[model samples]
Target chain A: MIEEETNSRREFLEKSIVGGLTALSAASLFSSCHGDDVKETGEKVKLLSPDGTIVEVDSAYINTNIPELHLSEHNIREGVPGKKFVMVIDLSRCKNARKCKEGCSKMHFLPKERSYVKVEKMQDSEMAAPYWMPMTCFHCDNPPCTKVCPVDATYKLSDGIVSIDNNRCIGCRFCMVACPYSARIFNWGEELYGLNDAEAKAIPDHDACSSHKLGTVEKCDFCPQMGEKNELPDCVKACPNGVFYFGNEYDDAVTNGDETLQLSELLKTKAAFRYLEELGTKPRVYYLPPVNRLFPFKDSEESKNS
Target chain B: MESDFKKEHEKLLDLTKELMPQKFGRTGVIWVISLVVIIAIGLVAYIHQLSKGLIITDMRDYSSWGIYISNFVFFVAISLVGSLISAILKLTHAGWRTPLTRIAEVIAVSAIAFAGLTIIVDMGRPDRMINLFIHGRIQSPIIWDVLVVTTYLVISTLLLFIPLVPDIALCRETGVNPSFWNKKIFKFLSLNWKGKKSQFFLVHKSIRILAVLIIPVALGIHTVTSWLFATTFRSGWDSTNFGAYFVSGAFMLGAGAVIAAMFLIRRQYKLENHITDAHFDKMGKLLVLLSLVYLYFNINEYLVPAYKMKHGEAEHLNDLFTGHFSLMFWSVQFFGMILPIFVLISKKGRKPLPAFLISIMVIIGAWFKRFLIVTPTLLHPFVPIQNVPDAWKSYNPTWEEWSIAFATLAGACLLMTIFIRVFPIIPIWETAEERGIIVDTHEEK
Candidate 1:
C-alpha cells in the first residue's frame, strides 16, 4: 500500500519538474527571439530544446541552458518518492582528504568557512585509535529537529530526506538544539554570497541554497535537486577514496561512484552501525567501524585550529 | 451611635486620602526618562539587528541562543509572582496578602507582556511571527508556551483589574487632585461599582472563581516554558525533573522580586504603615522556604546525573562543576541560592532592610541562573566540537544583545511605573473594610 502511494507521488514530482522547466525555457526562448536582435556568428550548435527536439541555433544565441529540471516548491517538499534514500560511510577508507567537504561546499555555494560536511577527528577512549569521521545530517526517521519545529519549517519527507523551508522558518533555533548530532546551522546574517539582492533572487529557488534568508536554520539537504536528475549527492561523487555510498534502501542497493553493493550484505559483512544509535533517532546513515587503518591518523590543519 | 458612625466614616475617608495615586516627583520623573532612553536605544539596536540580521549578536551556529533567551526566561520566572501572591495566598486565606496583590499582578502583567515580546526579539524573522499562529503545530513545546503564556496574561490582567473596580469607583467619587483623564478613566472602568451588598457578593464570587482558575494556568505557563528546554535531547536539559525544578526556582525568584518591590515602594511612597516590618518578616520566611525547595531540586537535577557520569552528561556537568563554566556555576549557586538561604534564615536578616538586600541578590542570581541553564547545555552537544571557529565553542553576548535585554527589563519597569502613576497601587475599599470602616458608595458626599 505504501509503495503504491509513493509511486504516484514520484510521478507527480517528475511531471511538475518537467512542466516547470518547459515553461521556463519557453519564456526564455521567446525573450531571446523578440527582446534582443540575434547576432548570428553562423557557428551552428545542436541543442535539445525543452520539447526534446534537436535544433540548430547560432552559438552566440545560446545562453547557458536552464537546468534540466526545476522542481517547484510543492515538488521539493513532497520529494522524489518511492525511494528511501540512505548513505553509508566506510570509516576505514577515509584518509582525511576532505574532498567531500569541499565538493559539498562548492555545490551549495557556501562560503569557504561554512560547510554542510565536517571531517571530524574522533577518538573513542584512551587506547582506541582515532579516525576521520565526515559527518552530515543523519536524516533520522524519528527526527527530533522536525518534531520540535513550532512553525513546521523543517519536515521529514517521504523519500527519507529531512528538508527545510527557509521561507516558512521563524528562526527560533529550537531545532538546532534538538538535533543530537549538531547537524544544523543558522543563517545568522544575510547570506547573499556577494550577490546583489536582484541577482540572488534571480537564482532559481531549488538551486539557491547559498542565498538563504537571514535568521533561518539550514543544514545538509542531501542535494535533492541533484537527486531529481538521478545524480548522487556532491559529497558522494567527490570522495577520492570511495568512502561514501549512496543508494535506495527499498532497492537494497548502494553504490560508490566506482562499485555497487548489496546493502544488507555490506552491512552484515562490515558490521555497520549508526552514530548514537541508542538515542533511537533511527538515522538513515550507517557507518562501518574504523577497524583497519587506511593511513596513519594525522590531524588536518583545520582540525588542529578547531 | 450616630457620633461613632461619623467617626468611622471620617477614618475611611482618611484611608482613601492616604492610598490614592500620587503624581511623580523629581526622582520618579528621572526614573521614567532613563527607562525611556534605554528603551529608545534598544529600539534602535533592534532595528539594526533586523536589517543586518542576528549577526550583530555574538551567537554562532553552536551557541545559537544567547542573553535574549535568558532574559525571556527571567521575565517569565518573575511573572509567576502574580499567582503566588494573589491567587495562592487568597486561596490560602492569608489576609496579609492584601497589600501586595496589586503589586504582584502588575508585575505579572508587565513581565509576561515583555516575555512574549522578548521571544519575538530572539526570532531570526520577527516578520514571520504570524506564521506561528497560521502554521502552528500543537506537538511543539513552543506552541504550548504561546498558548499558556497568552492565557496567563489574560487571567492575570483580569485578576489585576477586577479587584480594582471598587477602588476605581472610590477614586472617581473622592480623588484628590486627580488629572482630568484619570477621573474620566476611573469613572469608565469603575463599572458602576456602588458597594452594594449584592455588588460585593458578585465581586467576591468572581475573585474566587478566577483565583482557582489562575493557579493551573500559572503552573502551565512556566511548565511549558521549561519544556522548551527539557524536550531537547541535550545532556544537561534531558531531565524528567525539569518541571518541578523550574516551578520551585520561579517561585523563589518571584518571592525575591516581591520583597524587593515591597522595600522600594514602601520607601518611595512612605507606605511603611501598609507594607510593614511584619509583612517583610513573613515574606522573608516564604523566600527561605522557596529557596530551600529549589535547592533540593537543584541537587536532584545535578547530583544524580553527576553520579552516573555518563559520557555525554559528564562533559556537560564537568563544564558546570569545575570546568569552563565553573566560576559562574558556583557563584550563582552561592549568591543566588545558598547565600540567600543562609542570610534570610536569620531573624535579623528577615528584617526589612536586610531582606530587601538579599532579595536583590536573589533577583540578580536568578537572572544568571537562567543563563547557566540555557548556554552551558548548548556548548556541550553530543558531538565533539570540531572544524569551526574557536568563537563558536563559547558564547559571549555582544553590546547589541545586552542593550536589547536591558531594554526589555526597562520596558517592564516602565509598565509598572505607568500603572502606579495612573491607578492606586493598593486597593482602597478593601483596606478600609479590613480596618472595620464601612464603605457605602451610594451615600451622598
Candidate 2:
C-alpha cells in the first residue's frame, strides 16, 4: 500500500509539471527536438512562452516529454484515500545498524542527506547500558504544532496523518519548539537534489513537495508519497533484517518488504510500545520490545548512506 | 537678553534650553549616525534571516526564543515610565515633577515604539505579520500583548501631546528670539492658544481623564506581556506571581531611566537651578522604594521555587543560581536590584551625581536582567534537550543577534534624539506656572 501511494505521488507530480507549463514554452523547448505530428494530435492549447509571448505546442509533451512532479496537489486537508498508515519498529530486532537512516536520506533528497529519522544512543545513567534508538516523527493524534499556528497552516488530517500546508506556512517555526519529539528540520538554503534545473524549476508547488524551503519548516512526510509505489518505505526496504513494518491500521495488515502479518497479532505477540507515551501525543508509530535481541548490539556500518 | 537682573533665573532658562535637547551638535551627530548604522546592520541581518530562514540564529527547537524577546520585554518594561511619572506623580500630588515630565513622556513614546517593533523582529515571518490579525486566535497570549501594548502607546503619546499644546504656545508667543523652524513649528502646533478660562478648564479635565485611564493600561501592557510567557506550560514561566512581578520590575526600570535622563539634562544643559539637588534626593528615595517592591517580587519568583523546588523549577533555578547562567544572574541581582536599593537608602548617596550614577547602573543592569529572564528559562525547559548537537542544548547568541538587539535600543534613542531636536524637552509654560507667576487668564490680559 505504501509503495502504491509513493508511485502515484510521482505520477501525479509529473503530470502537473508538464500540464502546468503553458503550450508556448513547450514549443520553444521542444519544437526543434521533437516531431510535428505529435503537436497536431492533441487538444488545442494556449500557453505563455519563455520570452513572454503566447505559442502552441503538442499535448504529447504532457506524457512523453516531462518526468513526474513528486509533489501532488490533492486537497491536503483531505488526506490520502483508502489507507490509514502505521509503522512498527521492533527495537529487539538489532543494534545501531543505521541502514534505515541512509535509505530515508537518499529518498527524501535531504541535505547532509539527513531526514526526520535520527539514531540516538541512549543510557539512563552511568551504570545503564547504552542502546541505539531510532527516531521519526510520531505523527501525533493531538499535534501541538497545529494548535499554535497563527495561520492554520499546519493541520491534522482525518486519516490520522499530521500534515503541513507548506505554501501557507509563514515560517514562524513555533510548531518546531512546541513539538517535544524534535521531529522537524528546516530547509536552510536552496535545495541541492537529484533533479536538473528544469526539473527543479518544475518541482511541485508548496502543496506539491513535502520539503518546502530554506526559510520554512520541514520534516518527514511518512513516505506517503513513496507509499503509493506499492513498495515498502525506503527505511523498511533498506533494513536487511526485517526490523521495520509499514502497514495500514484499518486494513489490519503490515508488511516488512519480505513478509506480511496482521498489525494486531504482531503488536500482541511482540508487546509493542510508543516513545514518550507520557506526553499523550498518541503517536501512529509503535515499537516492539528489544528483550529478545535479533542481533548483538554493536555500532556497525549501517548508518553509512543515511 | 537684558530684560532680567535675576542672574540665577536667567542662567537657569539658558541652561534649560541648552540642556532641554538642543539641535544635534557634533556629539549628537555622531550619536545619531551610530544608531542609524546599527539599525542598518540589524535590518540587513533580519532580511538575511527572512531569506535563509531563522536557522541563522542559534535558536534550535529547545531554546526557540532568544535575545529579541528579552529586548522586547525590556522596551515594554521601560515604557511604563510614562505612566509612573506622568500619572502616579500627578495622582500623588507631587509638586516637583514639572521639568522631568517631557523627558519621561519622550522616553515612554520611544520605548513603546521600539517595543512594538522588536516583537515583529522576533517573529519568524515578519513579512506575514498581518496574519496576526487575519488568523488571530484568542487562546494565544500574543494577541493580548498586541492589543494592550498598542493601546498603551496611543494613550501615552496623547498624554505627552495634549499637555504640550500650552507649552508650545508659550514658546511661540514669548519668542523674543526663536529659530525659524522652531518658530514655525510652535506656531502650527500651539493652535493659537489664548489661555482662556474655558480652555484651561477643558485641558485640565482632559489631562485628568488621561492620567486616570493610562494607569490601568500601563499595568495591562506589562501584565499582558508577562502572560505571553506565563500562559505557557514551561516550568519557570508558569506562575501566578508573574503579573505583579512584571509590574513592580517595570516601575523600578522606568524610574531608573527617568532619573538618569534628569541627570543628563541637569549636567549637560546646566539645569542645576531648575532640577536641583533636592529633586535628585527625592527621586533617589522614589527609586529606592520601587527597588524594594521589585525585590519583594524577586523573592517570590525565586524563593518559592527554591523552597518547594518543583521538579522542573528545580532544574531551572540551578541554572540561575550556580549553573550556566550564574554570572549574569548574580550581576543582574546585585546591580539591577540590590545595590541600587542600598545606595538610595542612605541620605548622602541620594545626592545628585551619585544618585544619577546609581540610576544609570540600574537601567543598564535591568536591560541585562530582562535578557536573562527570557533566555535562560527557555533553555532549561522540562525536557532534556536531546538528539540535536551540543550547541542546540546550550545557547550563546551569535553576534548577529546581539547586533540586532543593540540596534533596536539605539533606534529608540535615535527616535528620541530626533524628537528632542524638534520639540522642547521640558514643558516651558507648565513649569513657569508651577514655579509661581501665573499667566493672565485671558489673551494678553
Candidate 3:
C-alpha cells in the first residue's frame, strides 16, 4: 500500500530514531525500543554510538538522547531546551580527586599554570572537619562573569553550561574580578599547555581548542561535544570511584557510564547539595556529601607548579 | 623660597636654567637618566614576560589581579588632577592657578596616557585586544569603560593641548621651532596663533569647551573604572559607595601629583617668582580638601562594611584591618588619607617642601590603596579557599610583574621628563598677559 521508503543512514543517527540501539549502549533505555525485545527483527537502521562507533537498527526504535544534547552550540548559549539548569552539590562525597578538574582541563587545553576547576580545601571553622571540595564553573543563570566581560566572550549555553568563546575575549580580567567562583582563567601569553591535536581528530575539528587562537579565557564546557558523540562526559567515566553522575534532569536519570540512577531519587537518598547556594549562581553540577572518605587528602602546599 | 624666587626669572643661578621654558641642567639630566634606566629595566622585564607569559608574575588564579591593575588605577586616578587643578580653577577665575595649571595639565595628560597603555598591560591577552570593539557587548560594563575611558582620553588631551597653543606658538618664535620632522606638527598645532582678538575669542571658546567637557569625563573616567570592580558580585566590591569613593580618591591622588609636579618644575627651572609660595599654599589647601573628601569616602568604604560586617565581609575586612594585608592597608590609609589631610590642614605644613613630601605620600598611598582594593577581596571569596596548592590559596607577586609595573611607572616619568624638555612646563603667554607685558609690534598703532 505504502511505497517502501529506504531507511536513511543519517535519519538513523537522529535522536528520535536511534533507540533499540542495544549494540551501542543501554543508555537508550527508551520503552519504544524495549517493546521490540520479543521480535528479533533487526530491521537494520544505521546508528552512531556515543563512543564514535556506528551501528544499524530497526526503524521503529525510540531515542535516548539527552534533551540538552540535541541543541546546537548557538542554542546552548541561549539556554537549555525547555527548562533552566540547576544543581545541588552534596558536601559529603567530595574528597577532591579532581577527576572533574583534570577532565575539564584536558578538554579545554588550559595552561598548566592555572586551574579553572579548583578543589578547594574547606573547613568551616578551625574546629570543623576539613574536606576536599571540588569547585567548578557555577554556570550561573545570572552569571557575574558574562555581565562584566568587555566583549561577548563568555555566554550561557541552552543546555545550561556557561561556555567561553575565547576568540572574542579581550583579556581584561574584569570577568575574573566579577566571577565569585573564580571559574574563569586568562591566557597570559601563548597556549603554553599545547593543545592536543589528536583529541580533535577523535571528534571533528570543531571540538578542539587548537582551532581557536591564543590569548582567550577558557573554563569547563562539561564536555558537551562528547554528548554529540552520544557518550557520557570524560569526568563521569574516568572517576574510578564513580563520584560523578553526568545526566539530564529532564528525564530524571543520571549515570556514571557504568551505573544508572534516578536523578531526584539519588539527590533525595544521598542528600545532595550545591556550592555558594546563597550567591544565587544556580550551578549545574551537584555533589554528594564527603561522609565516606576514600582516601586521606595528600596535603602539601599546592603551588602553581604542582 | 624667597631667594630662589629672586633668581628664578633672571640669568642662571649656578646650576638652574633661566631660559624661558628653560633648559635642563645637571640635576634634571641625572633625574631623566635615572628614569630612563628604570624604564629600560622594566622594558627588558616586559620582553621576558612576553616570552615566558604572566607566569612570571606571582598572581595566580586566586589573585588574578595584582599591582598592574592597582598601578593602572593609580594612573587613572592621578590623571584627574588635570581637570581639578587646571580647568576647574581656570573656570572659577582663580588667579593663583597660573603657576600650577601647567603642572596639573602635564600630570593629567601624562598620567592619562599611561593609564591608557597600562590597562593593556593588565590584559592577560594583549594580542587579542581588538575584541573590545569587534564583538563589544554594550551590556557589559567593560565595554562602557573602554568607550568612556577612550572618550576621556581624547577630552583630557585636548584640555591640555588647546590651552597650550599660545605658549607653544611663543616658543615657535625662537630657536625652538620644531625641526623638519616636528615643523609639520608645530605648524598644524599652532593654527595661526597671532593673538588677534578673534583668535583669542576662538581659543577662549575652545578652552572653555574642553574645560567643560573634561569635568564630566574626568568624573566618568574614574566612576566607570570603579564600576569595573563594584559591578562584580564579590563581597568587597559590592558596595554602593564605590563610585564616590573612587572619585574622591582620584581627586586626592590627582591633586597630590599636581602639587608634586608643580614643586619640581618650580625648583628645577628657577620659577620661584613665577610659581611662588602662594601657589603652593593654595594647592596644599585644595589637597587637604581632596584628602578630607577621600578620607570621608575611605571611612564610608571601610567603616560601613566593618559596622555591619555582612555575611562574608568580616573576613575581607579582617584581612585588610588586622589580618594578612593589615599593615599595608593601614599604611596607605594613614599616609594616603589621614596624614596628608592633617598636614595640609595646618598653614605651616602647607609650605612648599612639606606640601611636596605630603603630595608624595598621597601618590604612594593612593597607589598601594588600589592594590588593597583589588587583591584582598579576591583572596577571600564566598567559599573557602582550597585545592591545588597552599600557594594558590594565598597571593604573592612575582618579580616579573613588579618589574613591568615599576617600568610602566618609570615610563610615565620619562614621558613627563621628555615633555618638559621640549615644551614649557609653565604657561608663558598667560603669565605675560597677566602681567600686562604683551610683546606685539602692532601696539605702535
Q: Name the top TM-score candidate.
A: 1
Considering every candidate listed, which one attains the maximal DockQ?
1
True-contact fraction for model 1?
A: 0.93
Please write out the lDDT profile of model 3 over residues A71-127, one tens digit for every residue.
344343454343333344444556566676667656555544444567777666777
In candidate 1 the C-alpha lDDT for residue A217 amounts to: 90
What are the interface RMSDs of all the models? 0.9, 4.2, 3.1
Q: What does candidate 3's lDDT look like per residue over B1-445, in tens digits?
A: 4454334322212211233455679998899888888888888887877666676777766688888888988888988888887678888999888767767877777788888788887776778778776877898877777787788778877767876787666566554534784566666777777655566667778988888888888889899889888887788889889998999899888888888887888888777887788888998998888778888888888899899987789999988989989899999888888888788899999999999999999888888899999989888877666544567677777777787788888888888888787777777656665765532322212
Which segments of candidate 3 are over 4 A away from where they belong? A1-88, A95-116, A124-132, A187-214, A257-273, A287-306, B1-19, B174-185, B436-445
TM-score, per-candidate, Cα-based: 0.89, 0.78, 0.82
Model 1 per-residue lDDT at A253:
89
In terms of lDDT, model 1 sits at: 0.86
True contacts kept of each: 0.93, 0.24, 0.70
Counting only residues 3 or more apart in sequence or on different chains, how many pairs clash (N, Cα, C under 3 Å) in candidate 1?
Answer: 0
Looking at candidate 1 chain B, the ten consecutive residues that score lowest on lDDT are: B436-445
Stretches of model 1 off by over 4 angstroms after superposition: A1-69, A191-202, A207-211, B1-10, B440-445
Q: What is the DockQ of each candidate?
A: 0.65, 0.16, 0.41
